[model samples]
Target: MTVSRALSKPELVSEETRNRIEQAVRELGYVPNLAASALVTRRSGVVGALITTITNPILATTIEILQQGLSKAGLHMLIGETRFSPEEETKMLRAFLGRQLDGLILAYGYHTPETLALLQAARIPVVELWDLPEGDEPRTPVGQVVGFSNWAAGAAAGQHLVDCGYQRPAFFGYEDARENLRWQGFRQAVVEGLGIEPLRYNTSAIPHIDDGVAVIERYVRGELEFDGAFFTNDMPAIGALFTCQRNGIDVPGELGICGFGDLPIARVASPALTSVRVPAELVANTTVELLTQQIKAEGVGAMLNDVGSELIARESTARRSS
Candidate 1:
């Protein structure tokens, strides 16, 4: 026990005892088996996170920040991508359970019925990212939540588009619960502000630069008539902007674009992007803090944090067409 104290919690053991333990470990060439130790201690020193996508730059940064925060707390992160599938998320979560992870983090607060059931039974410390909790539904098994309001962020983007005087605002993206919330919010705002339902180009494909380029290319070919649009995130907005330039359609003059996430590249892109800035870093740091607290707390402390978001108006949406 003293040897374990010396190795795991060095400050808890006296220097004299630690020195002897170190010498013994060296003389015996004893490599402490973490697997064996975990059985007794019930701490694997690893936290797992399930995400929808690994390719999204915004989510990628959030995961990086989360890893750093967990590392400081003496825990390593294990990440799993679900490719936006509830079944895949459930499978990954089951794998994490098998590893006996210290805690779990989920990208989305919502989950499949089976996933919610498993988490409810496992009783593991869990913190879901990207969206705030809707309720304590019998189906909602998440303990802590740290993220922004997807609906509100979307509404803000739509409202901004209306303010910028884009006559016909359109939304472009794929559908999932979270993204659909954004779409609903954007739709609500655009409809209320402009008294017209915004156009929607929904797809089953994942959001990508190529998809965006193709949308703009169609418009350039005189196929699509949307003069202004809001993309699910930055990729498509930038793609559209690029195509507009190639076709000589002036941004804000003939076309307006807005996106979410406010990725770093958005600020520097030609014509600059107007976007809804999600508090990704804050969410990551808070999720770590809340998750660590829940793991170590006497009572599985619960938190539902909404860091909120802001809409950044820029050149892309600066025009007020007369």
Candidate 2:
């Protein structure tokens, strides 16, 4: 009807004529080619996802959920891995823009200004997840932001320890901004919030179970007195948990341990771990939903969706008597 202009010229052609033309086209089975349609419409039906490191299991899990969510919405996900470098991330963003994707998602919260400008030029939806900086900034409705506050999770761990009557506590994690944020929050809560300065330790890189064992050994052998411990992520926490078990040190009874990103094994450990529960799958689903909305120009406003996380109580860290 639009092609024939019959609606405009109803007097020129009868309704019967318009209906006949529609019926004939439907019978012939003419399908519009998306490539040809894109030439005029300028839509690729593709979303770009940039992860900090593809090798990291945590990030891999997040991306897996994101891909499934995008696929269900009939959108394709284009993935790029930047090894925690700003320059490399910019290059990846440019490459994605070259493909003319509808939206972009970055796993690392940090992005260079140049890349931000380039994304702005592309005028597509952009999302940053997993440790966004805390500040007063405008929400990117044109894009979207979805994830939890690392600072809050850290504070929660600190408060849990305080509530459990652990006076002396220690913080252990990598020396990155994400880890730092958690440490900062933990510091504030444990020191200023609860009026006790917790001993802080930083690792050069991602702390594995071996690293956890080493830290605990150093503390125990060096006479570092601590009643509780908080780890950056579950890997190191679990590491320390087993290390304590093997050393014949009682958990909660002797030293309380709390971890972040309550992984699956947190509950399965000999003494279940008490840690912050980050909904990895929820982050993935929301990222895809925001991207799909951006692609469709659905006018969904700037998404600063803060999915609330919970603290799972397990045996790894239990309250102690004063």
Candidate 3:
């Protein structure tokens, strides 16, 4: 009766009835057998994961960890790709919800009002990863969020560059707003702490190894002079590093490079890349933990948890001026 009241006519059910039902559930060892329960509740017994693109090498590891964590929590994952379009994202949301997912994990920041309203109407747990809008109001069936400070990671990268005493550092970053925060933080720190302005180049295109190769080559041919560069990500950083070596520029001697995400390649490059280590597995586990709490209606409030990041100095960025 409690399950019927809470799941069917929650509005008609009194608080006392809900509590009594919950208490009875505990005493009777009644577990939510989602397989059987889904028949009654019309849920799909799955969590919908909407991501930008699964093809990106960096995000692939994140997806792997997320899948493992979600699976361990007894939830199957249904995936949708947005192709970086808001309209497509909304469409994907409608499709995912049509299947009646028990929860949603969005790689993009937040959902549109139409999608949000639908989730509220359905009363499902939603988790937003990576980025989020500030000062969002609490909508019913509110989402629980967990992520790191991209800006803080960027600032730390800046501080590292400054501390290394590179007279001139160039910043190569992608056009994505999420990546821009890191570049902005990096630039601000370099300007304020060292009283020096770093040269900045925004990649009009998405991040790619060839993009890194081309930029470094262009700089070399044009006689641009810089002691170091902070590539927004590891792949491009590796590209730049090899480009420098090919051009007879001594890495960490004539140039220093740093990248973000600290992918395995970062540690395996000829000179291991010095990078910021983002705890992907921890982020994945924490996200699932928060979702689990939400599913149990455990009084989760507006969460701004930072899994945090660290700079690991490797051979690539280790050069000190004599």
Model 1 TM-score on a 0 to 1 scale = 0.91
159-201 in candidate 3: lDDT tens per residue? 8877887778888886765666777788888899878888888
Q: State the lDDT of candidate 2 residue by residue for 176-289, as single tens digits.
A: 666777787888889865687898887546546776787778777975678789987778888889889888889989888988777778878888999898888887877777
Tens digit per residue, CA lDDT, model 1, 1-322: 7787788888898888889999999999998788888999999888999988989898999999999999988788999999888899998988888888889999877688888888888878988887874422223536777777778888998888888788789888887777778888899999999899888887445678777788888787887778789988788788888888888888878888888789888899889999889888888998888888877765545566778999998898886847
Instruction: Please give each candidate's TM-score.
Output: 0.91, 0.81, 0.80
Candidate number with the higher lDDT (1 or 2): 1
Q: Candidates' lDDT values, in order?
A: 0.84, 0.77, 0.76
**Lowest summed lDDT window (length 10), candidate 1:** 133-142
Candidate 2 vs candidate 3: which has greater lDDT? 2
**Candidate 3 lDDT for residue 1:** 62
Q: How far is candidate 1 from the true structure (C-alpha RMSD, Å)?
A: 2.7
Q: Model 2 segments beyond 4 Å from truth?
A: 1-41, 55-57, 132-142, 223-225
Candidates, ranked, TM-score? 1, 2, 3
Between prediction 2 and prediction 3, the one with superior TM-score is: 2
Top candidate (lDDT): 1
Residue ranges of candidate 1 with Cα displaced over 4 Å: 1-3, 13-31, 134-141, 298-302
